[model samples]
Target: MSRVRIFGIGSSSGDDQAGWLTIDALLAAGLQCDDAMVIEKLDRPGANLIPLLDNTAWVILVDAMQGSGPAGRIQRFDQKDWPRYTKGLSTHGFGVIDALSLARELGRLPSRIDLYRIEIGSANPGEQAGDDIQAAAQQLARCIAADLIATLLQA
Candidate 1:
């Protein structure tokens, strides 16, 4: 039934790899789930993201955000609370916020949407994530994996 779907969005650049790294960590942690769970990694999906949420009961999106803070800090926002936190904040003119707004308007937004934004130190191409960001990605992935399991059990 695809009860839970997680989409990690990022490019291959420096700290932008947070989303991909989190997905890698989840796999390394040996997250076990039934066919009801789906995980994907995307590189600036843009408008292609809308259709992916169709019929999913819950959606968790992990991405990197450039903000005034030490890298690797984690912040979570729900579908309804995001606009308040990221007004006009779009990376490359299009990003999660735009995608979510489109989905909401089209009535394709999932019943539950969780956005995990990881503070990135830099997004310079070819650069790797700093130590702190790497560590945080691993920790966040583990936490999300555990939550997915608990949610699945309740279903």
Candidate 2:
């Protein structure tokens, strides 16, 4: 089982690509992942995400979100904060909260789960992510990298 797993979830649409871009940024930043650590990008995994959460000690999920905030605004959510932030929000169809709730019910959830959302202004098909979204992805990648380093040290 992997000790740490980071998943970037999104689609190919405009701002929806924020999660994938964050994964790209993380890779470009040269955050090395040994066998104990797994990093991947998933295209709107939804309920499919539940299976990936199995047997992981720590999990971090990144996705694009549409909120009142400006595009590229980043929000971090812990497991306890899901209820407050995820109401009536569905990314494509099924959402992270739904998958996570199922995982928790099935006893497959990791002890530590962190969710990072990048606010998006649009998800128009085939368009590239905006400059602001790209910048936020890079910033979030750096933050996540630092957090991973600290977690690894403590472990």
**Candidate topping TM-score:** 2
lDDT of 2 by residue, 1-155 (tens): 88989999999999999999999999898976787988899998878999999889999999898887889989898888898667524456788888998999999999899998999988999899999999999999999999998988987
lDDT measured at residue 152 in model 1 versus the true structure, 0 to 100:
70
Residue 9 lDDT (model 1): 90
Identify the runs in model 2 with alpha carbons over 4 angstroms from their true place.
none
lDDT agreement with native, every candidate: 0.84, 0.89
Clashing pairs in 2: none
Error in Å for residue 147 of model 2: 0.4
Off by over 4 Å in 1: 32-34, 87-90
Per-residue CA lDDT of candidate 1, range 1-155, in tens?
68888888998889899998998888788864567878889899988899999979999999888887778988888866887547423343578888889899999998899899888888889998888889989999988988887877787
Residue 76, candidate 1: Cα error in Å is: 0.5
lDDT for residue 16 in candidate 2, whole number 0-100: 93
